[model samples]
Target: MPDNGDLRDVESTPLQDTGVRVFAVPPAEGAGPGEIMQGFLEALTSDDPEYDTARKYLTSEAASAWRPERSTTVLANGPSITTDCVPGGREETNSATCVLTGTQVATVDAQQAYRPAGGPYRRKLHLTKNPENGQWRIDGLPDGVVMGKSDFQRNYRSVDKYYYASGTAVGATGQPAAVADPVFVRSKVDPMTQMVRSLLKGPTAWLGTVVRSSFPAGTALQKGVSGLAPDDQNKVTVPLNLKASRVAARTCSEMATQVLFTLRNLAPTLESVELRGAGGDRLCELNEEHAESAAWLGSARSPEYLYFLDGKRRLVRMPMRSTGTGAVAVPGPFGDGGRQLQSAAVSRDERTAAGVGNGGRSLYVSSLASGGSLGDPVLTSAGASPADRLTTPSWDARGDLWVADRDPHRPRLFVLEEGASEPEPVAVPHLSGRIEDARVAGDGVRIALVVAKGGKRSLFLGRIRRGGGDGQETAVDGLRSAAPDLEQVSAVSWAGGSRLLVVGQEQGGVQQMRYVQIDGSALDGPAPGALPGVKAIAASEDERAPLVAYSEDGVVRLPSGTQWQKIDKEGTAPVYPG
Candidate 1:
């Protein structure tokens, strides 16, 4: 085995969890084929920036061909190596083949988008002994890099790059709604520079159709420019290529806002970002305050109140910031209990709401303000039972209402534009099961659904594709499991731009609550502590708000850094404004 060594320099920074810096150790002299392979594998997991040490174990030809950034394959454990001499080689008779085998867990593409993967992983590396130095060097190998899941977690961090929703505008805000596109990057590396480059590349293929980038086409960092870091005032200056040099002031400001939002999470101390053109002339400088005004981040807006169904099956709410405050019914028809509601959803603006009542057979829209009468059901289902009728309605950022009708004979998902138009059936191609519940994302481009099939319920996330002016019907495409491990999902709500709070039971396990990413990967942090008998759950886009749930103990809330506390014994379905 090669001896471990410290290769830290003046510029090296400590690893994420460990305070000490870790670097790759070059192969030792006279090392065996197995030892050489082991050293090369270890080097792939190190923070060598350019992977210079890892290349040392490879022959010059192989080194020139290897592209570590092409893709990353994460395994369940470190790959196992088995080496054997070739039966009869041509040019090099003294060559050995090393086979690496493991179970693949996930993969990160060149675009930095992460997707859960499974199945066996196999790769081959051919080695030959240098005649002059008698040193073993890999002559042929696969592209990119492979490492264990633990190393991937320690070396990489997930960050969201900001984009604007493609075809919607926030009312009166005069700004497009901001959407988050999550990607993984090396934490200790020059992450700020990496993130900026990724943002300039535009949204990933999966999200490209629904979101638009502020950067102009072919926009990129100026040639040979790298190593971006915040200055003493926590400000970062980005130099863009010629394509972005001639953008107008407003468009330039929008581009700067995207950089500010993307870097803020990676460097919380970031106060502003200045964009410079290829000519080294300042294009625009956007401070934190101005950035907020440039885009509408739905998740950053705190709700005014927490809404839920009370004992009388009426809509009620309590101040979001006040704990231990008694809930009161709003001054509306649904609040007066004249028309009992089974479930409800409030619009993003909080001026109106949509409720499902009459044993879930009817859907009604009403104003939350005082002195308003409840209108007749805008939509109805002919399902035989309440369970087979309308699910809870959800309002999107565009004020459109979404709900699913689980009637086994006529199952369908409907969207009411502006919550007033006739119900329009949403086409979900390749959907195999009945949608038990549906929740549209605040960006209006994604939807989460709890689908029931073969006596099992699962959570799925899908993209909402609107028709081009040519009269194409709106459809939900690319449906994939969001919580594949959960055998039964009772409820789900968007926790953030790319996360969902889920209540479900794993195969042969008791019911529990956890957070899952839209890409079907488990979140990094600990899941919410176990809560018994969780029937339904709710979470605000703003993470600071408490999580509300309806369980056997009635409606309860899990405040930040605290245990679950009862909100109302009679409240059965709890919800926050979409």
Candidate 2:
């Protein structure tokens, strides 16, 4: 909202594109915090980017030192970011300064964990515009608990199309970008009796299921992927590719099934590009070549929730109303009093809901039949106020709610059982810094995963059982698994409790939509052919069909043994007419 000759402005990042003005840089290339402050003060009332001032006053190192890190990636997601912006008119001097309200961590070892990278901490700053740079770059680092640094936002997708954010590496030419909903193509592994018999035929047969034949008669495949034809130049349809064949193999540790998903370009050269994915455990990869698209611009069961990166995809959380009142509306979604459809978690029966967002807290239930008309937001803890925030929530087989407690300094994961009096914290490695994100499995028996200080990320599993003199936190199953493209696991959901969709930070072309599933007990026929364009993964009551929404693609439905298809849209684009 720092408006000035400022040149130009936008949301999230990249306020302006104009180059910096010519000026002398600081004598010290690696100047400290104070020096950076002094130079910024002098550059007040300048054009945006203020390239000239940095050139004249700051050494290349001093100027570039102002970059934001990974931990602070959410800073732009201000505690209270107003959609409205205020224009500049008031005269400024020493009364104002810019503030970075977040934390940072090192990707290396621990010793450096104590070091504060950069931020406003929790203190407010009085900022002034540089008539020259047209920005209010911090004169000095504000005050607060410094966490860590260098998170992976640049590689992350979900960008706003109307106004491109800076730091985005679009194409090799670095030109404008276009997209379609992300598609979630899944290969069923936990095989039914029939599946086991099919696989007996061998590898080629299994591979066929990964890509398979064409769309069925009167199929929505082509229309869903490309949308109404060339008449609408806005059309975006990219091909799908399966580079590796996904298989459920038993690890040296246990008999488990895992599925791996990487960013595979289904399109021909110019039409295709690479993207990033979530960072965490590695799973099996399904390699084939029948692409699908999920658009994010529809409502309810339809393809809505358009993401800048993926085209048409559908992912909708039921209303907070009783499964009886499933007809409720979600305005702007969060922020206001209206109900919000956060991430979804299907119960074994698919009757209960464990989503975290507006209106609802820990877990809520709506009849899958009536879609739970209940309008109350369910909270796991009932002690009035426990001084914690619930986010990225999930559920287990017992209908127990698994949620991560969001606290910069002392974060923990909570378990809310069906009839338990209160939610309890299963001890986790305490991080003096910040606990960014957490997720749980479908069975609800496995341990929770957390991303903490330093790029040194690890998974913690199991209960704090005591055996010897000193009690040690035991290791649970499936924790700290390595991922290919994800910077940090951003989102997690259970697809049949064993299979999962872990959304992470984007980087390079490797991570547009990647997922891994866990299955061990082999039943029968080789899993269903491929299901594509899935952004976020969730399970259905019968396990017959899986609900998926591409981070960029809107929403889609993958039936038991058929190719992917789109569900008709119900809600219109909140921003424009569909």
Candidate 3:
């Protein structure tokens, strides 16, 4: 079964139509050999956990030194290549990476959004050979969800006899045995208080990505600029570096509840900025009368909004809506919604302004002080279309905007609201793959959660229309995607109206920022273990706060607690516009 598709446009890559296949090749006839090692541990848990198909059946250096990012280093256990293979080792072949040590099996637990729902992962597999095609296959495993080796050697011999008999506690109370040794999961952080602390509220916005290399161009001190942030020890910028320069760029703006970062360098067209609470600034400097360009910018009230980008960035209906009296009418992105402005929302009594694209998909509401556009583009319709990748929208209280459509690889979620004709989508139930985040608090009730690309997930809170009606979601209770297990939970926010603020990873890969407190029950009792990427994350209904920003080389601040504070006296990456 070799057809995992898209392996460089088909040329033999078949891993059986995608869910990847082919494991145990030695078995000659009637099933047995533990059903060929349970179909070679279900083709090493589906696909691409990348051991490059277990180094083509492990041509061994003791199985790439038991590859788990190499470290712990081990080997020796060779003889048990057991797929039960009877008949004189049923046609053995040895070192095809010793089948990189095959082992896997977890039929279901739809990868609890990547760890936390029913928690349990230990999968470790391998088996390769295909030096371009001899065959064998299998490979890699544990991106989470393993359990099968006689139920993981009976839950690792009852957690190695409750942490070696008395040296510690499973639930704690007098104890004392011995024989421990096989311990794993390493991101720890649960001394007792956790269940995602009610999603602990307030302060959000942390988006930094600037790698450039060389130095000069417009050098705002980039290569390793941290300005401030020390404890949350994302190491205040671990070995942070950024010197090259393709004219850095990265944007984000909200104003008046703050979040106005726009570092742009387009070669000589300057615009540097740095503001979490507000610090580094220099808003503009483009030449030939500034044609810099406007990738994006939001906010239309508190402190003003609309700056799509000069010579008509469009959508300017703020406290500046004047037209008749003193005169001041600049509004152009029209809306009978024949579809023009693909994104923009302004209701909360700013009258109304919604969108979905031009040529009419529907979801438009206009009237910035009786203006011209906004007659349609408010909610568009027809067979579900308008979804330009939505990074983060969140409208709620019945206005319905809620847009965290992140989709990093099919990580689902979408909602438009108003009269409800199309935008629905929500499938996050046991989450399937990649989302990095989804926040929606305030009056949406709660939805904060961080998804994964490979386990380490926690900080849930569910409920907004969930219940038993198909999407099957009820209790949310979080705090297992690990905090006590150390740290990983990627990103989450809602910090007020019920609390919820997460954004994780501690110890080495760094970046730790907590603040959970949503009262339901952090996923009840168990289910913790999650971690992956995403370094910063924010969310704020203006102070309903939920921010966990971080950068490397320098700059850390974990807010919910009292330590970690450095506005980047070091950390780089924030040059802008990427």
Candidate 4:
């Protein structure tokens, strides 16, 4: 991969030597405070599931209280540590405490969900000599572990866990609508146990509102087992408590499927997921065949072509599923008139499109295949200047069009449902600035809003909650900061059910693109590499799909295993089906 500098810092050197580390086993005895401190941090990057070896550095009391499962913090770099003798000289004059500090880059919770840290983190390590062994051991410290970002990237991995949407009735579609919430977990840890615990804990706060877990409330793993184990036959059994026993056979099977799919990526061994009661009775077994058959909760149905506007200011499409090139102007009334298109969004079905016209003063919709206008300006701005007018338009899976009328005096976010004469205003509670663009996820329950404030921009994730039932217009209940780490977010797109491909500049840094979870945690992987001079970007639910963007070279796409290739040398505003 071409070097693009740190995704979070353009002016700084990129972190190097990200290969997996080989940690030496801790000393059998006589290790000092400094040695223990180093061993402890190294253990965070080790492949040990339970960190059994790292416990040797701590006193018996401290070891029993430390819980590495509480969290895994990714620091900007290896922490700086300093030690000094305790002022009052106890029985052992060599007794001392160590102070360590580092900038926290991100944090992964016990559920494995990743969240970027907002500031620096500091830790204290108190140590005393183990009189019996004459070894300086840690007597007190923080509960969890911390490691450098580069080391964290090499040791951790991002995985998705499946959950069904909330509003969908069970079995409405042979496959219930499923959304994937991505989380980061240690690659060598007992990932199966982590995945199970995450599933039982339900979705993260941001996703909790839109998706529901199959596991029952208060369901938990049987105590006394620190990690899961597989039988000689390779069948891994999951032991659940009594709360899960209340579920019906079919419900239990669905729950098993959730665990099946989530663990499928982590452990590809040959077998099934057997859900067991606390007493060891089998509740249900979800084999590979059964998991494969339950496809309702997933998404892989996007169109094969990416839609954009050609040099002639006309709507066009190019094949995305192939290595082919060239663009075909979609049959439509757009770009046919003296009209000039700014930015546009294609509906999830690819049947219709919403476009910003006349320098963002008006919004219009037209049929893509039928070649006709759906209506006269679905929305128009009363603002005077072009910058104070409407922004790009986007469509959600529910067939509703979303746009922001950035009238300086009356900035508003509006949603236009099919056949609605006037767009209904969607309230964005506690908006810090003017709305620049709005893109709704394919699930139709969340929206990614870019707000410009104080000469800078930031991205926020919001839930789409409708008030009136039936055919009433729905509104955005609230928006929460999605990528609080990115100080000047320029563009964003839903890369997966739980992850977003965000292009933004870090505070006082150059712009770059990275995959970030809705909870504001950057993925513990290599940067998507930089898109030089990129203006906008779009991605599909398939993480493997090539990203299409508009740059100085015109509409371009970074195809797999290749550099950016031009689709239309003179086009702008490239977009894909959400």
Q: Judged by lDDT, which candidate is best?
A: 1
**Candidate 1: where is the Cα deviation over 4 Å?**
1-20, 84-93, 243-245
* Candidate 2 regions with alpha-carbon error over 4 angstroms: 1-338, 341-346, 359-388, 430-439, 448-479, 482-485, 496-499, 505-509, 515-535, 539-544, 559-564, 568-578
Ranking by TM-score: 1, 4, 2, 3
- For all predictions, the C-alpha RMSD in Å is 6.3, 22.4, 24.8, 8.4
> Model 1: what TM-score?
0.94
Model 1 per-residue lDDT tens digits across residues 43-149 = 99998888999999999998999999989999999788855434254545557889999999999999998999999999989988888888889999988899999
State the C-alpha lDDT per candidate.
0.89, 0.31, 0.32, 0.76
Best candidate, TM-score: 1
Task: Write down the TM-score for model 4.
Answer: 0.81
CA shift at 30, candidate 3, in angstroms? 6.0
By lDDT: ranked, best first: 1, 4, 3, 2
The number of clashing residue pairs in each candidate reads 0, 137, 121, 3
